[model samples]
Every structure is written in C-alpha cells, then in structure tokens.
Target: MMTSLFDQFASPTMLGIPLIVIAVMLPWTMFPSPTPQWVTNRVITIQMWLANRFTNQLMTPLSLGGHKWALLLTSLMLYLITINMLGLLPYTFTPTTQLSMNMGFAFPLWLATLIIGMRDQPTMSLGHLLPEGTPVPLIPALIVIETISLFIRPLALGVRLTANLTAGHLLIQLLATAVYVLLPLMPTVALLTAAVFFLLTLLEIAVALIQAYVFVLLLSLYLQENI
Candidate 1:
C-alpha cells in the first residue's frame, strides 16, 4: 500500500479528465482583475510594481524591436511563477516538473526567436553559425559545433527546469520519509531531520521562483539575439 515518491508527480484525474487542465487554469483566477479606481488595494499595487520592475529588467538588454515581446514575456513569467509557487502547496501537482509541459513552453518560443532573426536579418542569423576570422581549417568544424549548440537551446531549457524541480521534489519526499520513520524510533534524530526538512522546504520555494524567472530570462536572451 506504500506509494512511490514519484507517484506524486503523476497527473491526477477526475471522471477520467486530467486534473492538470484544472491545475494550469487555477492560477489565473488567483489574480484580481484591474479596477478603475483612484486608489487600489495593496495587492494590486504590489502586483503592478513587481510587473513593472520585472519587465524593465527583462527588456533592458534588447533592441527596440524586442520590446514588442514585453507583454508576452511578462505574462508568461507571472503565469510560471504562480504555477511553481502553487505547486509547493500540499496535494498539488507541479506541471513544470514534467518534460513535456516545459518543452511545450520552451520550444515554440525559442523557435519564434530564430524565425524572427532569419526573416528580418538572414545574414546575421546565419552568421551566428560561423564567426569571422576563423582559419580555413577550422571553418567546417566551428560551423558544425555552433549549429549543434543552437538547436540544443530549447532542449536545455526544458530539461533544466524539469530536472531542478524534479530533483527538489524527490529530495523533499526522501527527507520527509526519513523524518517519519525516525520519529517512531529515535526522537532526537527525528527532530534534527524535521528541522532540515523545514529549511529545505524554504529553499525549494525559492528555487521554484528562480527557475521560473530563469526560464523567461533565457527566452528573452534568445529574442535579443534574433532582434
């Protein structure tokens, strides 16, 4: 009757419908819609401030053309952060821990940047494959290497997010199991294990926020290169 640690990552269902659909949609309702008022609540104020700051920081490195993505990227960032933080709650599934979901977000955005670069500035886009001043002997090798690196970006993005969240979740479950088992036999050891579990939970919360930010930030960098 014991459950596997990774069983928590599996998508739950209700009436045979995947609960992930609900999990993804639930975060959107957590935010309040903007109101037309002279003074807004503190929640609205703080949310606006965070959005502005994040957008500014994310767009600073890119050209004006990249500014067009400010809305899309900002919205995606908030959605991701909300999902990640919510997943930390009890009985919740973290969809980002799944490779398919992470890649669903990563690949299309990465490809869009590449397409924009190719469409608007084909020379510069292709030039990225081979740097200037390369020796004749090294030209083919360098081009092949760069080409492989370029295609690997999306895979790296998806795997990085999935790996980090999955690892954190697994460690947490292992520690929790240890604490429970130890409590029945060794009180002192159980207390120490519990304390470590608490700290690791806090760290996981931060990791959730950070991984979401890093995902969006990398997307922006890819866009910058294209723009």
Candidate 2:
C-alpha cells in the first residue's frame, strides 16, 4: 500500500498549500550545506562554460550576438528542466504547479523585456510596439491594446504552466486512487490504471520541457521584435 504525498493531498488549496510549501522548502534545510570548497552547481557550471566559450571566440558582431543569446536561452531552459524533473520525485512538491510560483518566475521575465527594450531603444520600443505607420488619431488606441497584450504575457505564461502541470498531476492522482480502490476486486483494472499512470509520468516530463520552451521562445520573439 505504498503511496506518495501527492496521493495524500491531491485536492490542494490555499490552506493546504502552506503544507506543500513547507514540504518543498524542507529540502533546503535537510540537505547538508556545502562547505566553502568551491563546489560547482550544475547550472552555474554550464553558465561559466558558455561564458568562457563566448569570451574566447573571435566572433562577428552578429555571430557574437547570436552566441550570447543562445547561451542565455539555453541556461533558462536548463533551469526549468531541472525544476520540472525535481517534481517527478516522490514526496516532492512541484512549485511550478502552483500559480503563485509560476507567476513569480514569469513576471520577472516580462519586466526584463520591458526594461531591456526601453533601455536599448525607447523611441523605437514604444513606437515600434504600435504598427509602423498608423495614423496619429488611431495610435492611442493601438498603444492601449498593445500595452494590455504585453502585460498579459506574464499572466498567460503563469496560467499556462500552472494549469497544465496541475491538470496532469490531478489526472495521475485520480488514476492512482481508482487503482487503489479496484486492486483486490479487479486486479486487471488496477493494472491498467498503473500502466496509464506510468504513461502520464512520461507525458508530464514532456509537458515540463514544452512549457519551458514555450516561455523562452515567446520571450525571444519579444526581444527580437523590440530590440
């Protein structure tokens, strides 16, 4: 009768989310702190390696730009991948499955877009956001609409990842419950449910990566268009 933490609190809510928070954070306290032995975290190591490669290369301006961007994007992708895989473990809470956590990550991304875009080319950033040659009369209306869309990006990003992960997690939970119920009476049904649960695990892995790619790709598009 082995089960997981997810099986215990599949119907999560505001009240219970705190418990999940504690569960997720407990690892930080439980894991032995690293000594000042210059231990390298995987993401940090990758970032340093990429930075060194970029610095060493005699790249053209355009080539250098592409290399820098690719490295930056790859780092983001790796980060998301690591977090998503951590969620697949037993007794672990997937923070990304929570709306608040997803919003936390996504909002900063939108803010960076705004700050970077404006800093690099304020006139073009604000002006280019609207259509190239719209009449002055309609420009105000266009700006309002475009501004709303720009803000909505973070909201959309948060909801998309949270909703997808939440749904997949719930599906696995429900299937596991059904399997538990039918185990003695209908072993075949229970076995089928178990098989489906394994499949869902694989599917969740893909969803995690896909959502990360989507977030980064949309961001890259915004940067390219504005800057």
Candidate 3:
C-alpha cells in the first residue's frame, strides 16, 4: 500500500509513546554548561557571543524598562533555533510545526507584553485601540478594527511559524518522492528534481533559522510598544 504524503508530519512514537516530550528536552542538552573560571571552553564561549549579539540587537530599540526582557528573549531565540534546526535532520519531529505548540509559545508571551504595557502605561496601551486624529464617523469602526487586530497578533504569530514550516516540509517530501519514483523511469528528469530538492533543503535550513529570529524579533517589537 502507498503511504500518505503527510504521514511524515505525524509525531513519532516508540512503544506507543510520543517522542515529542523527548524532542522538547533534547535541545537544552546540546548547550554546553558554563564554568566558574575566567576562561571557558570554545563551545560555551561561542554560544555566549552569539547570545549576546542577539540580545544586543533585540534590545537596542527598546527603553530601559524593556532591557529586563533580554534574558527571556535570548532564551526563547535559542530554544526555537535549536528545535527548528534539529527538525530538519532525519528521524526528528518539529514541535513548532504544530499550531498548538506555536500558540503555546505565542499567546502567553504576547499576553505578557500586553499586560506589561497596560500596567506601565494604561493610557498609551488603550490608545493603541484607537488612533489619533480620527473622524467621528470612522471612530467606532476604527476602534473595532484595531481591537480585532490587537488580539489577532498572537494568532498571526502562531499561524505564520506553523504554516511556513509545514509548507516547506510538505514541498520537500513531495519533491523527494517524485525524484525517487522517477529515478529509474526517467533518469534526466529525476536528476533535475534531485538537484532542486538539494537546493530546497538548503532553503529550508535558512527558513528554520530566519523564522526563529523573526519570532523573537516580533516579540521584541511588541515589548517595545508596551514597555
């Protein structure tokens, strides 16, 4: 029997147990632990440098109040980057591809930003629901629209990450299947498809990294508006 094209996305299982729990725990194990000594291993040193660079870039636009989010943002970026990149490897499951997982990440954090903004600057936070210099005729309609969009932020964030990764994985699987089937029947065409598949894999790797960065970047922007 032919297998389902989408079966690749099903969460892996072993002895009737889902592997997602393990997948979530796996990323943290990759990071090298830091030492108390002044000098450190190259791995830890490089990790710290990259992390600092990410925080510096992420926090530069925010006010002093937002700087406190540096640790949260940096940790999030690393967690996402590791999970996304690892998913590209064989025999791996990407938790981020699931909307539930993405929303779990998005909603709480997005809500946190909103809560911070409202707590710190209630007038400004509420003002975002209705912009300045609005005509009376458009006032009610604009308020409705803005309120809808504000709540839509977390949904958009969850969907964007899930959709992109799912689409890329689906396309990669389809192309690889085509190449495998045509290898004997049509050598030249199979060769072309194989080349395309190779290029597509590289693009997917970049997407994994870029999507992680964009996720964190948007969070930072949300925090900026609030704090």
Candidate 4:
C-alpha cells in the first residue's frame, strides 16, 4: 500500500498510548541545569546570556505589572523553541503540529490578556470596539466586525503556527520523496534534488525558530495592550 505523505504528522503511539507527552517533556530534560560555582562552563554562560537578553527585550514595552509575566513568557519561549528544534530531528514528533495543542497554548494566554484588559481598564477595552471618529451610519457594522475580529484572535494564533509548520513539513517530505525516486533513474538530478533538500531543511529550521518567536512576540503585544 502506498503511504500518505502527511503520515509523518500522525501522533506517534506506543501500545495505545500517545507519545506527545514524551515529545513535549523530552526537550526540557535535554537542557543542563545551572549550578553554583566560582565560574561556569560555556553552555551555562551562553544560556544565562540568552535568557537575560530574551527577557529584557520581551518585557521592555510592558509596564511593571506586565513584568510579572517575565518568567512565564520566557519559559514559554524556551519550551517552544526546544520542541520546535527537536522536531526537526529524524523519527521525532512535533506536538505543535496538532491544532488542538496549539489552541491549548493560545487560548488561555490570549484570554488572560483579554481578561486583564476588561478587568483593569473596562473603558479602554470597550473603547477599542469603536473608534472615536466612526461614522454614524457605520457604527453598528463596525462594532460587529471588530467584535468578530477580537474573538478570532486566539484562533488566528493557533492556526497560524499549525499551518506554517505543517506546510513546511509537507514540502520537506515531498522533496525528500523526489530525491529518493530520482536517485535510481537519474543520478545527476538526484544529486541536485538532494542539494535542494539540504537547503530546504535549513529553511525549515529557520521557520521553526521564526514561528516560535512570532508566536511569543504576538502574545507580548496582546499583553502590552492589556497592561
């Protein structure tokens, strides 16, 4: 039987148990924990530097109240980048490929921002629904449209990450299949195809990193409006 190209995305199972849990947790285990010492190794030094840089950049625009999310957001960024990088490895599952998983991450966080806005600044939150200069005739229609867009934010977040990762994986798989097929019939073309596959793999790596950063960046933006 011919196998589907999309089958790589199937959630891995062992003895009827889904392996997504392992995939998610495995990345964290790979990270080395810091320790107290006169001096640290290069790994620890680089990690500390990156952690500090990321947090400072992320929290720069938010108020002091929003700085409270520094740990949570920084942890999330590392978690996502780890899983995404790990997924690029052979025979590994990417939990973020699942829309359900993506939604699980996006919804609560987005809702938290919305809740903060409504709680702390009800007037400002409601004001966003209608612009100050909205024409009289378009007031009702504008409200309806903005309300719909507001509710759509979480869905957009989840779907954007899922779709970008899914598309990249599908393209990589297709090119790989082509390389295998061409190897037997046309050695020269197969070599060129293999070259392209290598380039695509690099692009996918960048995509994984970029998508994770974009996801967290958007969440920060949402939080900024609230705080």
Q: What's the lDDT for all of these models?
A: 0.94, 0.70, 0.93, 0.92
lDDT by residue (45-88, candidate 4, tens digit) is: 99989999999999999999999999999998889889888888
**Candidate 1 lDDT trough over 10 residues, lowest sum:** 83-92
After superposition, the stretches of candidate 4 with alpha carbons farther than 4 Å from their true spots are none
TM-score of each: 0.98, 0.68, 0.97, 0.97
Tens-digit lDDT track of model 2 for 1-227: 88774553343457555565554554444323334658867766775675466334312233333345665666566566666676777766677777787788778867876787688778888876598888999988998999898789889988998888778878877887788999999999899989998998899889887887787676666656555
Sequence-dependent TM-score of model 2: 0.68
lDDT of 2: 0.70
Runs in model 1 deviating more than 4 A are none
Candidate 3 global TM-score: 0.97
Winner of 1 and 3 under lDDT: 1
Error of 3 at 191 (Å): 1.6
List the candidate 3 regions with Cα displacement exceeding 4 Å: none
